[model samples]
Target: MQIDWVTVAAQIVNFLVLAWLLHRFLYGPITRAMERRENAIRTRIEEAEETREQAEARARELEQERAELNARREEILEEAREEARRLKDRLQQEARAEVDELREAWRAELDEDRNEFLAAMRTEAREGFRTLADDALRALADTTLTERMAEAFAARVGDLDEVDAERLRGAVRRGEGLVITLGSDVSGALRGTLTAAVRKAVGDEVEIDIPESSDDFTGIRLKAGGETLDWTLDAHLDRFADRLASAFPTEDARETQDDDANGGRGAGDSTLGDSHGGTAAGGKGQASDAREGAAGDG
Candidate 1:
């Protein structure tokens, strides 16, 4: 095919003009629309990505919150359990202390009651024994016991200590006469025996006198100058009562009785004469000049 240069040139020029027109109108508008659409899509994609990141952050926060809440719950539960244990132990301790205190109080009460009972029994027994002894001695008053007692008492009087003997001797030298007083119940034989004993103990030439007394005891009392000696059955019995009181004293009276015993030595003590059974030896040799002072009137 032969090429026509002018027609080809003209056709080329027309095509170029048409392409330019399309570019300026249709192509330009289509390209701009497509670019705008692409921009919008990109914007939507970026927004979706930002939303996804925010969701992920929110999920992480929720997960962390849940973990912390779970940890807090566990800790609270453990604390509550420990508190319960401590409370239980405290209550148990209180209960044990209360029981021990109650037991101690009961024991103290029992001991007090026992001591009271024992004291009461001791008092009863002591009273009973004293009554029995008094009755028996009264019944046996007129027996050989009296004679033997009188002899023993006279012997004790004869065995005076050096100090008492000296006192009696000095009193005899100063005094006018010796006085011998006998209990009203004393027998004639006893009076004669006592008179002989006095003469022997004093001196062969010493004065002897026997006087009557309104006492109920079968005892003798001797007076020389200002010195007096009593050896009465009543006195012996009183000494016995004192000994009995000491031996069976109660708690309340023991302190008082102990003080009395320690304060001074009484007659019938174990030192001068043997007073094993409430018997006291009463005698001393002291008489005035050689004159016998008849006791009945003088």
Candidate 2:
């Protein structure tokens, strides 16, 4: 085959024209559009990746906050429980102390009541014993003889102190003599013995007037000329008190010596009886108490 140069040249010219036309109409636009589409897809993929990362970070922060919140709740609950326990213990302690105080107070009140009741009972018993003694003495007087009593009484009246006899005389009329007052209850029974007691105290020649009073006044009242005497049970009690001068038993002899010394200082022993239940100077003892208290002031 002969080389077709003309034909080849002609064909090459035709292809060139067609290529230029395609580039202008189709290739150029297709290439530009494909490049723009690729850029848009790449931008979308980058935006999706950034959005995922943001979501992961947000999840981590939320989980950390939840853990802290849980811890705070646990601490608050523990504090509340501890406070409640402390309150309960304090209430219990106060209750126990109150109960103890009440018990002590009740016991003290009961003891006071018991002591008061016992004291009242003791006072009543003492009164009853005194009442019984009064009843017994009255019985003895009813059975004694009267005639023999008169003789004995006359003897006692003569022996009593002159001053004591004088106080008894005060009760008698001017012409009469001294007087002796016996208890109305025991007058008859004591009449003989008391007369004997007085006769033994004063001299035998003294006149006697024995009268009875309701109370215990086993004493003489004498009113001789102008002077008067009073010897009563109250006076005897006063004298008996003098005998027990000091409470100490060691002072017995000293008291007797003082009584004698004081007796020597005065004019004479006007007092009835000796220290052992003798007659006193009746009312003179009231004045002598001042002297005895001064002189025998041991």
What lDDT does each candidate get? 0.62, 0.53
Over 124-178, each residue of candidate 2 has an lDDT whose tens digit, in order, gives 4433433443454446543322222234344444554455554444434355555
| Residue-level error in angstroms, candidate 1, position 38 | 99
- Clash count, candidate 1: 1
Model 1 score (lDDT): 0.62
- The sequence of per-residue lDDT tens digits that candidate 1 reaches over residues 125-223 is 444444454456667664443455457556755775555555556666775356777554457787667767765666555576777554444455677
**Clashing residue pairs found in predicted model 1:** 157-283
Q: Candidate 1, 117: how far from true, in Å?
A: 27
Error of 1 at 146 (Å): 3.8
Instruction: List where candidate 1 sits over 4 angstroms from the true fold.
Output: 1-145, 216-218, 234-298
Query: What's the CA RMSD for each of the models?
Result: 16.8, 18.6
Candidate 2: which stretches are off by over 4 Å?
A: 1-59, 128-298
Please report, as a residue range, the 10-residue window in candidate 1 with the lowest summed lDDT. 285-294
Best by TM-score: 1
TM-score of each: 0.32, 0.30
